[model samples]
Target chain A: MNHIFSFFVLGGIIAAAINGKIDVVTTAAMTAAGSAVQRAIALIGIVGLWMGIARVAEKSGLIDKLSHLIAPLFSWLFPSIPKNHPALGCILMNLSANILGFGNAATPFGLKAMQELQKLNNDPDTASEAMCTFLAINTSSVTLIPTTLIALRASAGSKNPSEIVGTVLFATTCSTITAIISDMIIRNLYRRRKYN
Target chain B: MTSEMLGESFSWFIPGLIFIVFLYGHIKGVRIFEVFIEGAQEGFIMAVKLIPYLIGIYISVGIFRESGAVDILVKLLSPILKVIKAPTDALLLSIIRSLSGPAALSMTMEIFDTHGPDSFIGRLASTMLGSSDTTFYIIAVYFGSVGIRKTRYSVLLGLLADFASFVASVYIVRKVFL
Candidate 1:
């Protein structure tokens, strides 16, 4: 079913390209791949560094202490996940990676979070509310530095490559806020419908 | 080395410091090799999963470019560009650039070489490419790899964000730098 939708979108794009829109599409694809490769390489290093740090932190008990410190805040944000759940730890690790703009690094943590979420779910077919909420937040993840953007800007020869930092911060914050609010609203509406 | 050269040498110092830190961590019982291999294995698996979507995205991009649809859309949106006080050339260039970075960069470089990098058009193209995302590629690759069947509002939001960045890049570059 979804394959059809994908086919249509692909067909539309191809049709456009054939009709002389190829220049734009071709350029976008090439650039995206180029940027993705460069970003991925940089991300591997960054993630490696962070993961090493995180591992050390865990070994030294800092992660536990830090998790304890941030437990209240995390609990407030994710009331769905029990405080002691392993998913909470995964979520924190994922969030930390995301905050640092290490999406490559965050990917494992995100998967781990999902795995943990799956364990807590009684129904294997339907996604849990926690899963939905996590997906919502992860999809609209807020990034402070936007390292990839900075790298792109620098490569594009921006004199002040980091100037967009403030704007990105504002935009991501708005997106995250919107995601959370919408998730809550939809969940509430669904609950109401089910009850009524 | 000269004093100035010595001062410039410190640029290498930070990376050296990082290497030492990594080594120290490795020696202190961190199984860096095993973890890295594990991560790489996962990444490879993800890359395999993403191939289909990536192909779809590439094909779509190919069709979009060939269909004359973008040109029509560009023409239709020209009036809106004027209202925003952005140069029509820059606006079009940005849209194209966002879709393809290297092509955009090459275009920017061409414009820069011909008109100079200090030109508004060159700066605008560079800025736009820098700030905005390759929306279709992101949707197809990232979301697809994760097996997100329904994108819901993500596609709309991503495109909207791209547009916002496109406009803002022009505004900032023109108003502040240019």
Candidate 2:
């Protein structure tokens, strides 16, 4: 994978150089680098702020209360996850972050959830049902506020930038439903394969 | 005037809500400050881990855009986009949308500035921004952090979802709203 990625980069640079677009390539690369830095800064700032809030929530038992409040919903969505597991907490945090449109922020929690799930798997070769379900949910998680999108819109200079709120809600809801349905179908297939 | 309009629109309400949530969470004994510090510290580490991959992705996107590859691809696909009744500008916009929200916003702003916000292109860009994901970064960081070696299906599925949202946004906005 690293080799392939390196090849792509090298090939792209060589191609650009041959085509006499090296300057353009360089500029584009610089712009991209600058943009990445900006994105990192924005994400770090936002995620840090939220993490603090989430910490407070955790310390205050709000996260626990939230877990309980949303447990039923989570159970329905992720039946494969054992009740009262550490993965459950991580999954909840991941979901909450997604809901807030903080994909960057949701990432570590999602990774932690996966790590916890990995520890529970008895077989090293195959992923457990819970892990698969969690991945699907995380990938297709619904986003409500889309803070990043709003920020982008604001930066882009859109008038009434928040106008896409309704559309985002509808689209993400659809994606989430699609993801859930697909996950169920796949899981069922895997179960039949294992048992039959 | 625009800022005033935005303020009048109660735009601050969401940020306020975020603040309230944070406060509530803190009050619940989360030790928000400490946890936040810990998380930020983690983020710093994550950023360092990502340096190599970030360099790769940024360079690739840069090359694509700079070598006129993006433009060539966009031009080639423009007719197809038109046939599908999607906006040409949005195809490129969506690609950049997730990589950098601010850049995407500025691009959208430029479109809106050049062509009035009510224009088809402007509306399409707006809708695209709302609907898409930042695919590469999400895959790189989240999947990388988890040490998931194979992302064969997830990446494909994510991009597909992004495509669906992009196409659907145009269709819904044009057919139903506009």
Candidate 3:
């Protein structure tokens, strides 16, 4: 993040000096900060509402129930995870949170899942296959309803804030499948090379 | 056609989700209202916490744009973007989506402000943002916590997913909206 920040800032300065747009850059930097706050303020209500409901879902065991629904597929994805193991449960919870787009809820469970997977690892320092798979899944998890996204769009005065929901679902499904398939193929290749 | 049908029903999706969540909570004997208030307070805090990151990203990206740097960069990548069917404006969001969440959000904001959120690029940005996660951040935190040194295939897998989602977002958006 630090590097990205400095790059954007210094890059902008250099480009402005070259283009003679220092005045425009100054004005943009000034208002951009103020506009960011305004956007965040506009975001509070909807994000709050969604988070509230997400909490209700979590407390009600709806998240657990949803995780249970995906348990069969979960087993198929991480067959190495022992059946009914704590790691499996943790992974389910994390993936459930991700699918709901409750990122704040997802992170803790994800970390816990990684810890459990580490417990099963042959080497503590090197990532195991399960850990790699879990990492892949989390990074490209399927999000069904991206609450923050819809909120941002609505705040931006979108004609239809939820209109992209279907597209997101399809796109994420494709991405997740791509991640899984590529991980499997690469894992196979690595194993072959190691044995050969 | 199927996507269009699904998109059409989205208006009721959130309302239904909320109703189900509350109803399930009630059935489970959970204190829905109290829990909701508690969570909403956390949400408010999250929003406040985001202010600094948002300010930093928006200012830099905004300056970058006004300075005409973004245009030059976009032009350099325009050929690749055209081949991928991604809008020139939404390209940064797609790349940044895998790297940083705040920066991607700021870029989306800039895109919406320049091209109305209902525009093709705007919708493209939203779909890309919604579908993808921050790959590098996920790898760092999850692997970092577990003290895993060799990420091996993780980086390749995560980036492949990110790239696929970007391309899929572009194709799916054009298919559904255009």
Sort every candidate by lDDT, greatest first. Answer: 3, 2, 1
Q: Provide the DockQ value for model 2.
A: 0.36
Per residue, candidate 1 scores C-alpha lDDT tens digits across A1-196 of: 2553454456556655566454555665565455455545554454445444444434434445555767787787777777756677767777766766666667656654665676776665455667666666665555655555555555656566566565555545655566567767777777888799
Interface CA RMSD, all predictions:
6.5, 4.6, 7.3
RMSD of each: 6.9, 5.0, 7.2
TM-score of chain A of each: 0.71, 0.67, 0.66
- Taking the tens digit of each residue's C-alpha lDDT, what string does model 3 give over B68-145? 776677678788887977766677677667656777899899989998889998898989999999886677557755
Per-prediction DockQ: 0.17, 0.36, 0.47
Q: List model 2 lDDT by residue over B1-178, tens digit each.
A: 3434544444555466458767776565555566768756765555555555566667675666457554555777787687777766788887666454455777877887788565678667766766665665565655555455554345445555666667667776777467
The lDDT of each candidate is 0.57, 0.63, 0.78
Model 3's DockQ?
0.47
- TM-score for each prediction? 0.60, 0.72, 0.66
Q: RMSD in Å for candidate 2, one decimal?
A: 5.0
Candidate number achieving the greatest TM-score relative to the actual structure: 2
lDDT for residue B145 in candidate 3, whole number 0-100:
53
Q: Which segments of model 1 are wrong by more than 4 Å?
A: A1-196, B1-36, B89-118, B121-127, B170-178
Docking quality band of candidate 1, CAPRI definitions: incorrect
Q: Pairing residues by index, what is the TM-score of model 2? A: 0.72
